[model samples]
Target chain A: MDKDKFFSNDPRFKVAKKEAWIGVGLVLFNFVWWFAFAYGLGSKSPDEYTYILGFPSWFFYSCIGSLIVMSILVIVVVKYFFKDVPFEEEVQDIQNQSDKKSS
Target chain B: MQEYFLGSRSMGGFILAMTMMATYGSASSFIGGPGIAYSTGLGWVLLSMAQLPAGYFVLMVLGKKFAIVSRRYEAITLNDFLKSRYESQWVGILAAISIIIFLFSSIAAQWVGGARLLESLFNITYPIALTIFAFSVMIYVIIGGFRAVALTDTILGSIMFFGTLILLVAVIIAGGGVTNIMEKLIAIDPGLVMPFGADGNLSASYVSSYWILVGVGVVGLPQIAVRAMSHKNSKSMHHAIIISTVFVGIIMLGMHLIGVFARAINPSIAVADSVMPTITMEVLPPFLAGIVLAAPMAAIMSTVNALLIMVSSAVVKDIYLSYFNPQAPDQKVRSISYLVTAILGVIVYLMALSPPDFLIWLNLFSFGGLEAAFIWPVVLGLYWKRGNKYGAISSMIVGVTSYILFHQFYPNAFGMHTVVLPILLSLVTFVIISIVTEKKELLQAVHK
Candidate 1:
């Protein structure tokens, strides 16, 4: 129930916050690149094009580029973002509240 | 009175029922149905039949354990439940971001579908129709929250059920009967009335993969997942399962079949998405058509509103409250929630303005993305003892990244949906990482 103790002092949460920033970084990167790709090359006709593995050149590049970026974000979150912080006290408090209400 | 959050009691049972139906019955049934039917023919109807068991599958798989765990954690939203169950901030963030991104796209698709339906019916500009549709939803959702959404869904669901039945009758009557329609379809192309879709292009690979996307994978969707946690007990869950299955089956089959049969009656119709509205106007009288058309609009608006609230909640509740400002006042949280929801709606509207070629594909793409991002994290977190933060993080990353990659380059990579590969890959990653990182301290606490 103590907000500061529950969040601020939790070492695991600090790690989680840092990992979230990594995710934020990935989102920002993808957003920018997608905007650029859409504006710069998305307008080109197939006649003015290159190809990759039987697909249009622009489509191929966009697919690979976005996947790489999303992969990086996923890696960061999985490797460094999550923390196993204990919330026993909070769980107990919630349980007590439910029990009281039921009775 | 406060227990309305548990399940509607003060709100009449009829209203509650209506809300449930309306919320669950979506534009996928209305606009997407007729559109698919027109393009693929009777095969599309058979393909749609996979959705009949969706509600039962989700509720049964999740069961009572899911709800108990969610409530035990004081988790109000599906994101909230996932956050607590996994005990992983990364899972929460991934779940939150995926919901925001994909649900925004999904909402935009619905908005476009709603606006187009209105434009056809009322002779209004697309922009005006969109504005009207958006405002009507925003007002009710802002006022009523989930309760309003559920109640409205029940009403909309009833309308959808009856609307499909009535339209089916009308279409059969207008087409001179099922026998005549079948002969006409046969004359044009025998494949049109066949169960494999027009031109035999439906493909076993694609049709079977939809069972994962629309059927089994629906369990992971946050909007639907929250429903499992909302029912009062196992009894309500059982009742809901039966009711939702029958309702979904009737609507999906009826709408898609009507679409396939429309071609026999009006062979000259172009722009497949407009087939439903076109067919409705032709089959029913004007005033009746207006009312009947509202069923699709109802489906669209209900879906849009649910996604809006969900995305906004993810932003306000999961990210902002939990991470950014844990000490913020309640009033501030409330205001921020409202502001974020409105802003998100605007962004989705912009994205939807120039929609992709196939609206259903766009919606399904979002569905696949969310399922991949959240399924392992939520499911494994609940059942597995060794599901640690590291595994949760890894599962989400693998799930979402592979989903995007597969969707882009090789949509049916290895003869399966993009979601299938990612879900499998993530489960492997989760097990590997969880085993490698397991510690006595982390393993000891179950309740925590």
Candidate 2:
């Protein structure tokens, strides 16, 4: 087995790396928004808390609010940015190229 | 054997999403998480939501390249991927051993959860319930195979989603309203309404560290990672990412909220794991109650099914087929696979006989260990061209050992979960070792 030919010899790996970065960004956004709201407003005493939709202001913004935001962002990003690549073997092309050279 | 293990990798978006959800949302999320929420209050609910983006992380990180690479390698299992990528027999064997050890405990915990659910629902004895649950699972796994599990997951995932919603609405109504529930919870304990647990046990550092345990590091789980290869195309992968995130959000948020709200309704409930089912019976009609109760049962069954298939494949495909019987015929492999699945089911059933008081810890323990061991190897193997077998083997060895040591002796070291330190250590070890070994190999090539 040729070690150098193991990875897909095309832009597919690049596409995956880009998508992975976007995923990291989305997750970071989720954490930052959730942490700020959950800790900022939620640090107060219950009596000191204001309620929204019968939830503590922080809880609403942090859990439910962040969830809705994440869903929309995920849909938009995956729709616009993510590529639809073939799931089959890309290394086959590399093998063919090497075989032609050898022949 | 390929179809038996991976359904020939022909799954579409919807089945892919549902199967991943059903497999990931185990008894821990359904039974143990809510139980903790019932005791810890709203903070635990927030903590559990850290798992909301789990599907997003797995699919997005391992989405396209993982599929292409595995197919190129002709890999059917996670260990096969590791073995091919790292080009080391030891790497494959170590991965298989890790899966068997960690997943064994997880499967036993799920069995215990299934039996306990039955005992509470039907007034059946524990042993009888355990026997019934084990047989049903073993029979389907032996006969229906991976396709059956995937198809059944569509139904089970739906039950979990709608059941959580229905039971949540009922609980809110039974408590009079959200405001009423909040007030009651406040009256019982004001801390219940805050971001921290009722006892302030949920610190910011601790809760945030769960992002690794259940969130980002979930990409390392073999049971979940293998699903990345099964989708028909990257289009389905995209669809699955969004669909799974939404499903996970609803189930995790709704179930934990119901757990917290149960405290408002019945403040004196003794056992915490019973909170979900107990509240369902209290609030909904008997018929509706039965339907809603299926949510946790769905969670338990689907999870056990996935784990059983994974462990079975580790034995038959990764170890047996690779090492002992590489030239074994398809007919021989098929029979051996079924026999192995049944035998593993019996072993887990025996383990479940002595039930643990709280099974979530066992599940979490397994999660942390698997994540630490596999995260660096899998992630780096995909992106970093320089990583070699030396790096992979050392990373896994160091990851598992340090995780156990930290979990045993210095838990919550630096106010983070036990997993954080091991992950960091393994990453460093992988990089340094891989760089050193790659240089040595280059020097050898020059000399030759």
Candidate 3:
């Protein structure tokens, strides 16, 4: 019951760790994009505001625009980068056996 | 016990996504959120959209390792995961206590919102409405358990999505289109059209910090994180990440937009929580409004059901079985589960009877507390091998205490949410303590 080896030695852990970082990166990206448009374009007085498709430009870009873009980006990341790992208990047993054979 | 608590961990992508969305998009988003948006204007919408990445962050962060490890540990609840990860009885006890206390407030918020929605929708008295909502939710939860919740959440989640889209369009049309609504909102208050609030109360820092409360920090919500362990496989988990992100983004954006636009049509509504129902009844025909209003009901019901199940499991399985009656028979455990769920519903119902002015604040307060308490222990415990019971126990204690003290004395300290400071302190505590104890454990191992 080597707990450290049990987690770290599994191939799934490495992939999951990598994906979690990407997940965090995506969240940060969402915040930065949201902040830039929300605060950057929105900092001006409301009198100087412009409209796009009936939405005020700042609200349009910041909330609606980010929603569309983040949705697409999340789908792309999951489709391309994320892998399908088996959840069955036996998969770990198989993984252990394979590891023994390789070593 | 497995089937009762976790639906035998057999949920697929759609059910997983729906259950997660339905659970996360609770009375706050459906009612309290929109109510605030009704007054605060489009800036509040932008602020609420901080929740756009909630499902994505939770599933992605806790996806694979959480599922595999929980399965390995035979864990059913979040406390179960904590108990095994730290291998400390105190960690499990502390987690159960936290879940019961914080989740009670949140469940009460949902109850208040649900009763209010019913009161507004049916023109019924608040007490009757509260009773109706409580009875229906309890009956199904006590009888059907987790599978019923997941299955119903799928239907309810769809209702919420389409309901929001319909209400948004209806509100727009009733207000003479998007351009006209914008013009009217501007004429009322120029700030209404800006990224700041109608009163310019929503500052940039406060809004950005919400990303932690509703976005990334969502990984720490036990109700949501528990879903990460229940998905059938990694492929479905991937599908769920995409599906839930899309659903949450649209529902949040649409509901908030309806709230803002409702201001243009009916600027005189008094209570913020009533804005959603009032506007729906105003804009749509009676039949259509009835259907649209059910969306919030669905949201509240599903959320309450999920929380009820979790709390009952925490009390019955985590506390009772582990400590009081380890050899309790299946029949007794089942009866105790039903009894706990019913009693919890009654207590929350009583709490909701005194209804707060803004249930959203209550909801978000609980969110901050839960996130502050569990974020480090759960996340660090999953990743860092060195993290142990001391780090977890210290982090939970520090995080929960500092969060409460900050929330009490100085909410939104430094223009950031009160949750920000405690989460930072807890992270530091977890790392330093884990490192210090790693050496101690190493010494003990060598002596052995």
lDDT of 2 by residue, B379-440 (tens): 99998888899999999999999999999999999988999999999999999999999999
**Backbone clashes in model 2, listed as residue pairs:** none
lDDT of 3 by residue, B32-74 (tens): 9999999998999999999998969898888788898998888
Indicate the residue-level lDDT of B48 in model 3.
92
In model 3, the runs with Cα more than 4 Å from the true position are A90-103, B444-448
Model 3 pairs whose backbones collide: none
TM-score of chain B of each: 0.93, 0.98, 0.98
lDDT of 1 by residue, B1-448 (tens): 1222223323332443344455556666688768878877765765675554464456545544565555556677877777666566777887788888888777877878887888788889878887887787777766666666776677777778788888988999998877677668767876665445667766656665676687667777887777666765434554565466556656776788789889989888776678899999999998888778878987887787777778877898889988999999877887887788778767876776676656787787788888887777776665565677788888878888998998888878766667788878888998898887776455676537
Superior by TM-score: candidate 1 or candidate 2: 2
Best by TM-score: 3
| DockQ for all models | 0.02, 0.62, 0.69
Which whole-number lDDT from 0 to 100 does residue B331 have in model 1? 79
Q: Tell me the deviation in Å of residue B216 in model 1.
A: 0.6
Q: What is the lDDT of residue B372 in candidate 1?
A: 84
Q: How many residue pairs clash in all the candidates, one count each?
A: 11, 0, 0
Model 2's TM-score against the true structure: 0.96
Error of 1 at B186 (Å): 1.2
Candidate 2 at residue B88, lDDT? 89
